[model samples]
Target chain A: MSASDDIWILGISMTKFGKHADRDVVDLGAEAITAALADAGITMNDVGVFAAGNLMGSAGIAQQLQKQIGQTGIPAYNVSNACATGATALRTAIMAVKAGETDIGLACGVEKLAGAGLLGAGGQEKSVGHEWTPSGRYGAVGPIDGRIGTEAMPGVFAQIGMEYLHDHQYGGTAFELFARISEKNHSHSTLNPLAAYSKAMPLEQIMNDIMIAYPNTRPMCSANCDGASAAVVVSGEKLRTLSLEQQRRAVKVSASILTSDPFEQACQVLPNINTLTRNAAEQAYEQAGVGPDDLDLVELHDCFATAELVHYDNLMLCEEGGAVDFFESGAPWRDGRMPVNVSGGLQSKGHPVSATGIANIWEVCQHVRGEGGPRQIEGAKVGLAHVIGLGSACGVHILEKSGLAA
Target chain B: MSTATTIPFVDYLVLEPEPHLIAHECTGCGARYFDRRNACAGCFATEFRDVDVASDGIVRSFTIVTFAAPGVEVPFVAALVDCDGTSVRGNIVNCPPDPEHVTLGMAVRLTTVAVGADDNGVQAVNYGFEPR
Candidate 1:
């Protein structure tokens, strides 16, 4: 990529992540966009393109949101890849800027899940499409028979956890390790004012919480919340046009990669062991010219406690089946080396599906800018953000402090 | 009283005297999938043929779901059963949904059971694996 192709994150903003029953999806989205524009010190007219992502909203959400925030009639796109919706939207914006199609672009993600039923209905009036229904729903339109037709999301992860335990020979220690992860995330949340749950939760409380699925309690699962996050990115030429102060605060987008799961023998039997995440992370590291060991901080998807543990290996932060030992070594702690999820992650910050990926980006950008107050990692330079959706897809991004400004 | 007619819980199930799940195998790469595919993921081969999966297999993994869709009973055993070379996901019927009974690698045989009823009052028969 040429210097002209480089994309710089000019501004990032996120709404407080928690239940907002009164707010609708558009309201959440508009607020984030307005804030991002204000933070970038650029007006809506300066934004040449707009990209939006959400799982539940109808089509043309980007235009709808832009209409609410002064429609410049710039080209707008709506991107969706399940939980990776936010990052996908960001990737779209990066593509637009890097392609020289636009000088300034905005990527935003908003989801209103509070008070919605277990599925977090995004207020979509009609079903848009159908895929393999997990066991819970009645009408599963696939060929596999004699398969459990009613297992919900929690159950699916529980099975994964069970397989991990059985394969790693962890026995009872696996559950303990999971609780420790929850505890660590909860502790991290205490320092994150934007998190949904800022109060630290004890390991015992997490372990003893009502079991939604075997090996997973209430705290072990990411909560459904209503939130939105947005980022503004501009091309390197546009960065030169910015004020000196803004340039100093800007973060460079080193790499962004998105991938999907390949068809394998079975849904559970991932071809290369969570290949989607691994491939995305590997591509991101190569593009950024940095490996897992070089990452100063990371905000990975933790929809389930077990997912965080599995992703440790998937992201190559540790060797396969070494997540337990990694957790015990305090390597992922807020003050420890390679601190992760210091923005409280999805577990404590709440996962509003479409907003999750951008929320991860917001956290990473904060650390890279040295703006993370209480949870700030000292002298953090390189940061990574990762998110996955089970349909399924994964997105990974690497951000570094701009050397030109620093 | 209306007599309940038995129907395959899922459309792909062939509910005969000896029940077995249907799978589509790619002729080019010998890869199998429960759903129809336009192209084989392994070899990108388009040709496929229908085959019946084995009735018995070992439990690769299992979980007791405490919450599920409405009208679906909770606390049921959902498992991934390896039937011969293929892995099948289904509920473990005729066995308790506890770790003591639903251990990994436990042998299980396939059987048909009532999952629920359709709108027309026909009983939906679904297949599941049970301890052999």
Candidate 2:
């Protein structure tokens, strides 16, 4: 693609990921969008299109946000793809700009999930106290999630982690290995001031915390919090018309790819999380004309420590069946060869559902622009941001400092 | 004095004379599914036929859940059993939910459990696996 056809992220911002009891969905959305607009030195009137994503809120979130921010009367899109909702929303804006439909596009994601305990399996909302009638799909026993098997995120990811170890023949210390991964992410959180829980958790603490599942503990899971993230995207050609300062700080959108589960018999019921992510990674690398080795940093969906271990393989950061060895080598630590989740990841940075995807990208964008504060990876150039939602959607975005940019 | 009619929790579960699972096997790709699927996930074939899943299987993967949402009991063994190449997700019962009792590749058999009953004397039955 020509430089004129390329899409670039001109500005990005994310709210401190934590409990915001006084804030509602629109409040957070407006805050993120306004800040991102100011970051790019632009206003809502400059945006040709708007996209917004939210999980628990009603439809037309983009329209609602416009009422609070500024109603430019541009085409507004509301997107949701489980946890990848934010990335999907951002992609909508990028696609619009790439298609010449817009010169500047705005995207934002927001969510408020404070005090919302163990997130339920999406799709199965067991009727609470509703009299069990003998006429439905299950006859009388509702969709068996907790009763028989587990559709719960913790149990599912725990099983996914164990299955990877069992499949790879990593035994004996498999549980401890997972705990160590959590410890690394929690430690990384200490450098990230915006993280929800920036405390460094000892390995023993993570292992001894309330065991949500066999291999995963409470500390190893993503913190349920509220926050928002937004970004402004512009066509590369249009970006040249902006101020030199804005043009110099713009991050090139090297690639953006989304994938869903392909038919796999073994994990049909559980939904294969690996293949989709690998597919997205492959596509992203090919699109960016770069390999995993080129990434200076990454912010992947570490909803659970178990999920993070498998993603190392899924993201191709390690060779096939090399995830265990990769961790043992400490390559994923912040100072390691390939630092993964330098911003504490979802475990401590907090996962606000729809906001997580863009927040991850924001983390990468910050480092690429040499503005990552204390957690910055020195001279970081290329970065990858990834998020996977259990409806089986995976989004991978590769970003880099444009050659023409500072 | 009341009469209780026991019903299988899910339609695919059979409890008459013996406990077994019925899978919706795709005619095109031979893929099996415990729940009713409109089309085959593998080949997208709209044809399906019921096939009896083996009552005996080996535990492929298992997790001992120790924490759960309110009102739901924890410390249970949730396992994915592979029966004759068909994957069945269910709980492991009649044994402790720990490493000593439940293990990967352990032999198990299908068993039925009475979940609960309603005011009209209707008992709901769910399926689980037990160490053989």
Candidate 3:
């Protein structure tokens, strides 16, 4: 869609990202959706389409969510693309509006991942031992993970981080540098009251924490928690009819891009987090008509401490192989020239998987609309939100502050 | 050499002619893959040939994992080894999982390990790399 026919985010809301033992996915989903609808000053009747994202839940989260709120029976679309599920859901709604099939749309992502350990391990560790035993009809298959390197998220991201440093030869201090990146995100989380962790993690603590993988300690990993985030999108023409308050808070969707791997020779076995992310970032910049330097802030996926550093390069926030230099310059700090993950990032804000995608966009929206309180990037105009899932899907979105007057 | 009683954990690993990994090298573009592929990712070539990979490789990247799910051992070196032109993912065994023991570009050779054994006296063998 062109800039003139832009889709605007009229309202967005996120439940405080943390463990909710008492609440299920539908409970959290309904809460965020209700809050977003209220923020838009509209009811479910006004929503023309609905998209819901939940990674570890049963089928039809959108219908279940509607049952909690008002059931308008709008065309519901369920989406799940690993950690990018939320962004995928938001794009579904945005696409509906962009296609002229609807003027107003609603999207939400929710997940309950508290105490879910090591993401992809999926309780396989329980049966794992030096010698595999006959557990099922498939027979004794031992732990395939450690046996054939690792498909675990921690190991994958750790390899990706170290591989970048290896390719660049940054004076052989990958561990300390990665820890410092985690320190910045944890520090940023302190200002984000909604983050799962609001206390700043000292760099030494991050460096010394029990290592999940080399260069990535336990605290350096994204915390698994239960949370939900939702957004309301309306066509530019339809948004013009809204009240002054609604129009003032609207954030324009500059670009929405998603990408998957393009078949590289060596990256087949190892997850190529770099190529797909770079492709998405490049397309996003072209679509938005803005380079990385124009971004006032960023909320790229920091699934691991290693991930954030590489994404600096992936997002073109620095020169080729200049991620180390970018961090050294302190440009990604909360008050630095190009602030990033001011909402604690996935590292500290908590990655509820599906919730993270829209949560990242919600962070950008907060800063662009001047709604960010303590963590605000002053006079922020444009921002980017990014997330990547290892089954190999990436979503990059560019958002801008509303320029129209009531 | 593996006998009739042992089985390679993954199909790509060949146990008879020495512990080495094989790739589905695309005849069109020479792209290598461990898993079965319908077509070449690079040039969309439908034909592939079994190419035996070089046994020795350089450590392109590695991670010393200290934490994992319950029952999994810790402090193992998981590494990505570049065997000649192909990239191989496996564990670095027969050495300490530490910075002093494992560094980038360390020379290593592929080796086989007995992962598990069933009641029929058959063993499941997996491939790993060790310091050369």
Candidate 4:
């Protein structure tokens, strides 16, 4: 196998994604990293590099983690790419292994938002700073702009939902479809032990919930929490040297692609769907030599109910304006064809920003290894994980059961 | 006696009572940007010219924001307006921020309003798209 094809994910682990008032970001990160190491049947001594992701933390986080896990004098990188930090870190590890730079590499993502003074009361922190304006390096429109008055995240997505509904011909009302998406994810969360909300919410309750924004109630939005997730990747040669049991459980990293948005003058006004996500997903599918039809499941960034609906089309899983039908066909359910977000996604799984991307990978790895207990897609062999950040970066990774190909 | 002073909220907003937004237009590709551009992203041209964006446009998408940062009032319409051939993001004012009042394709005109006043009695001015 080529070096690119030789990269394999040996283990994955994540903390229960929710408001961990008692834990620091570092503690959450260490717990996940330690769990991942144990799952890989290895120790920190065996890890050649550590790539850590955090958005609202100080620098030297990777070094801090290294100190806690016993400093091995290995090079550690601290990655920050808004919400896609985890996936960016994971891609760094994949590159390291693909380039023969390391036999074993670790990628980790951690975030602590609760009581971090990040969101401040009234959700005013949602406003975009002047530095993020069109003149900035990460030039992309934000959910809220201070000069334009505080339009929070829910409001931003609500606009997209309304426009999408008006522009498309759907069998159901936009509100109903949004509620359905929320209800579906909540139902899927019931089976995920690590999910923050495991109880199935009725469609009525979701629709009737307190409206944070027009057409978007509180239930339609992802919760801000504290959590971490980590994964260990190794070269294919290293995988072959492992025990038969380990080899049997290994998952191959078929593709890891990341893309950023091109400079656009009118990003928000031009259909709220993410162009970067489509670009990244296309590259990932090509790199993996697999199409959307061949995948067993997907774990996408569902930051809001409308986001999930928009992504169904952006990922090319269905035709444009066909997401409502796709959901109505029961295709996105756990047992349905091409199940999505069996982990409840960010909606019910809890979105701790940086941790979210790694959490998606953890869920996909579980499915690929046939380890997803009640939520498993039976006979699942191939899966996709996708995440997008607002500073506007998108990451897509495809994984297949080891020994299934090549 | 206190005298009222006015200042632009952002450098891009022209402070005339009947104000209009300005954009940096690329000489090569005609791509317009709200902020100053060092280079054109469309045609990679180093030359640009300041152009006045048309004040009238239709609402492409809108939302009523009920939650916001401190000091900003709730239930305001945040909209993306298509002005002439370019798209601009701003708040839709002079109308109730609700589904009944803020509909798609609503015609809006660009106008300036006071955002806040400093301790020195200087009124900070910001621009928005109002019902035409």
Candidate 5:
């Protein structure tokens, strides 16, 4: 869809993710909000709406967060869409800007899951009803939870990989290339002080590590994390009024699209997922009047390393099945045409459910603002962020240098 | 899987006759959904008839978990099965499934096995997967 030219991302902040037994969830949020306000050189009074993306946080949690942060009378609404909670909040903020609600709004996502003692997501999840009547004999499709866990989840990836393998006759490298990709992210995590798994291992070690799912090792699985993150988004017109350096640091959200997988698109979809990813990219490019060839860096969801390869095809960074070619050529790096995951990724940064999508935007914001100290991609002009939520939903957003830059 | 005919949750909520998974074949939109939906999320069809599902499916994706919690079992498999042109996930059980014979497109049937513990020393049964 068309994004309004008025809304721009001014500043973003996130608490270092990991189990902080000492800090309460509200405390974590308070810390991030303070950091965000300071980062944007703004105060709570500038925030018109308190939009919170909290998936697992208890009810009335936003009230508690605001109380802890010293009572902002702004309206706070809680948003949840499983793991995509944060992005949903971001979406709301963008919608608010487009609707002429407020010039500046706060989009914050925080979850205090670590100390809450929940390990895996959905183990204790409330089972929403799926409408059905027992159909024919015992020869049909199974139900949910039947196809999860050990052999099941891996079975899906391995099957898809094996199919790809059978089709391309490429196996060993698929796993190896994926491992290298995972290892690179893991290594990149060390640079991110907020990332959970900072200690990186060699590809040899990752290859030898205990397998979690077939063709996937434990390292490939995103770590369960607990953290809080916040961002201050303002209208582009307002951002231009800020200091020249601040304007240079502002990142503009171009096109943000959320779509589900349509089966008819499957035939053409898998073969041309690159087209699909590029389809969204093209929309963002068109809305922002930028092109895929213009993006300097990206933060594609690397929940699993293999996903990134699929994404390369989907994002139209290369032709379908040409990810292998890009990997071997060492392109899409810091110096490559498009640097990816300059802030590590869910693979290495630790996927904190609600905070992940917002954290991704936070990373892109830092990259364009030149705050990513060591891992910074020089001359980074535009950034793209994409995340796929379950229920087969996907959202992609594009951001370019805001008005406040050096 | 219990032959009990009634599906219950937590020994408290009794889902009478147990909601069996049925798909709605939309003539208007040509979209199908497992279990009934108010309207196809894809196609808003208010009219839908229940098509009883076959309990069999091909294991599309599978995983083996070795992480054993304090009171939990390990080496169990979780998988996604495709049958009737759709996929769903559940724990894979029955014949000691060899990871090798398990192909992505391997065929299997749905087995409703007791998962958690029950009133007696018996385990509470629900739906899962077993080798076809």
Candidate 6:
């Protein structure tokens, strides 16, 4: 790998992942950014640019954050791509560094979902009792049940589960296995004091809980969390100038892939999930010269736990119908072949929308640097962080061990 | 709520023979998107043209709600109808607007129907899916 191929995460930080009604968006964003700067052992003066990620904050959130954080004169900007907003900010930072625009940059994302409290897009026309009253609607199509109207996120994904069952009879046991996966993540979250919900739930409890959607339950859905995460990315040559101690622990970003939704590929029944994720993952592997099997860990988009099962095959870690079998194999466990999530994931750790993607990246950087504490995979040299926004847009990034990026 | 005619009251009301719903399609990506778009979300193609979505499809799934929390609904079926391969989660008309009739995977069609005369004495047609 050339010197130009080198890029390392200088530092990463995140606020507690939970509903902090007392705090506002700017406070969270500033806290995460300042914490990241301190962790990187650098001052704000070292950062040449700023990329903030936010969704549904009160208008002009980017400008407001800059003023709040006192990063006034800097190139403060915001990037929005739904759930992938955070990671997209990180990508912009990486591009800036790669294009010789800056030596150090920051990608920080914050969300205040609990504050919004149901920003219902389901506005109804007033009824003076003239015509029939319709239910909450989606698009030109009026209100319908199960598809979108008030259905649980996992419940909506269950339609795919039904289709999956029809396509391949992946059974009840597969869900039980996913519960085990969640259990492992919860155990990790318990060690992570900043995590929203850290209680380790039993597999049986998840399997038998009242269904939110068929074959889906409340536990399978990622909670609508409120929090923030920040990361500092720097050129590889910059790391080389650091002390031996810092050099030993520096993590390198190998590849970053950002993409929009495919041609009318609806979230429900996304035909060729394998091809979509695999295509993106393949580009990352090729750019990084690393394969999926070589990855020490991954933080996939488990917005719905079932999607995690589906992605096992989509990421080409297993065959088409092999997710159930692979899950049953227990190879994706913390102590198993390749520990995934280990950070509780969205399932247990929580999903703060715009902040999830970068949070995943920040966790990977820590894991690769042997700083993941209890959730750390033993001898992790390569890690991947994945996020698929609204089951539409997606991104996958590969991070290498210190001094191993090409 | 009954707009039923008594003695052949077809003097002022005239129903179109070929009832159709106006919609837009992205010429760039050959995908049928109901809402209008300046660029194709699929392929980023800038070309598009107006199209009439066949008011027909199978009712994929549905639910009927009776407003009890001080709401104004006599009763209506919230139908998810798949129109000509494009599954649209919309409402169904023609029936008594009951959930039982709005069965899952039932054949349906999309068409413009004039419910009644509006305040201006002109026809007010809305797009809805109904059993074929």
**DockQ numbers for every candidate?**
0.41, 0.52, 0.52, 0.41, 0.18, 0.11
Model 6 regions more than 4 Å off: A1-3, A115-126, A129-156, A160-162, A169-184, A207-211, A264-276, A404-406, B1-30, B36-132
lDDT of each: 0.80, 0.88, 0.87, 0.80, 0.65, 0.66
lDDT of 5 by residue, A7-104 (tens): 77777898898888887667777888888888888988788777786766677666777787756687787887655677777777777767667778
TM-score of chain B of 1: 0.88
lDDT of 2 by residue, A165-201 (tens): 7688776676799899999999999999889999999
- What candidate 2 gets wrong by more than 4 Å, as runs, is A1-5, A121-140, B1-4, B120-122
**lDDT per residue as tens, model 1, A1-406:** 2335588899999999998888788999989988988888898989888889988777878988977888888888999887889999998888888888888989999998775545521111222343223242333433232145333566666677666666676655556677788899999999999888888999989988887766678788887889999999999888888898789889989988889877667763422237788889989999989999999998988887877887887898888888777877899998888798998877789999999988898898888888988778888999999998777889999999877755
Selected candidate, larger DockQ, 1 vs 6: 1
- TM-score between model 1 and native: 0.90
Clashing pairs in model 1, backbone N/Cα/C closer than 3 A = A135-A149, A135-A150, A135-A151, A136-A150, A147-B89, A147-B90, A148-B89, A148-B90, B9-B125
lDDT tens digits, residue span B14-129, model 3: 88966778888989989988777788889988999999999999988999888776666676788989999899899999998998889888899999888767555668888899
* Number of the candidate with higher lDDT, 4 or 5: 4
Q: What interface Cα RMSD is found for model 3?
A: 3.9
The 10-residue segment with the lowest total lDDT in model 3 chain A: A131-140
List ranges where model 3 is wrong by over 4 Å: A1-4, A122-141, B1-3
- Name the candidate, 3 or 4, with the larger DockQ value: 3
For model 5, how big is the iRMS in angstroms?
8.7
Candidate 3 positional error at A31, Å = 0.9
Q: Per-residue lDDT for A1-406 in model 4, tens only? A: 2454578889899999888888788999999999999989889998988899988888878888888887989889999987899999998888887877788999999998664421322343333223222223223222235446333567667776666665674435567788899999999999999988788999999988887766777778887888999999989888888888778888888889898877666763343346788888898899889999999999998888978888888888887778778888999998888799999988888888888888998999998898998888888999999998765789999999988324
Over the stretch A1-406, how does candidate 3's per-residue lDDT look in tens digits?
A: 3323578999899999998999999999999999899988888999999999898989999999989998887899999899999989998998889898889999999999999888775324553234434333223256566666765789889998888887887685788989999999999999998999989988888888888998889989999999999999999999889998899889999899999999886787678899999999999999989999999999999999999999999999999999999999999998888898888888899999999888899899989998899778999999999999887899999999998883
Colliding pairs, model 4: A124-B69
Estimate, for each residue in A7-110, the C-alpha lDDT of model 6 and write its tens digit.
77888888888888888888998898888888888877788778887887776666777777665477877888777889888888888878777788888888
**Alpha-carbon TM-score of each model against the true structure:** 0.90, 0.95, 0.95, 0.90, 0.78, 0.77
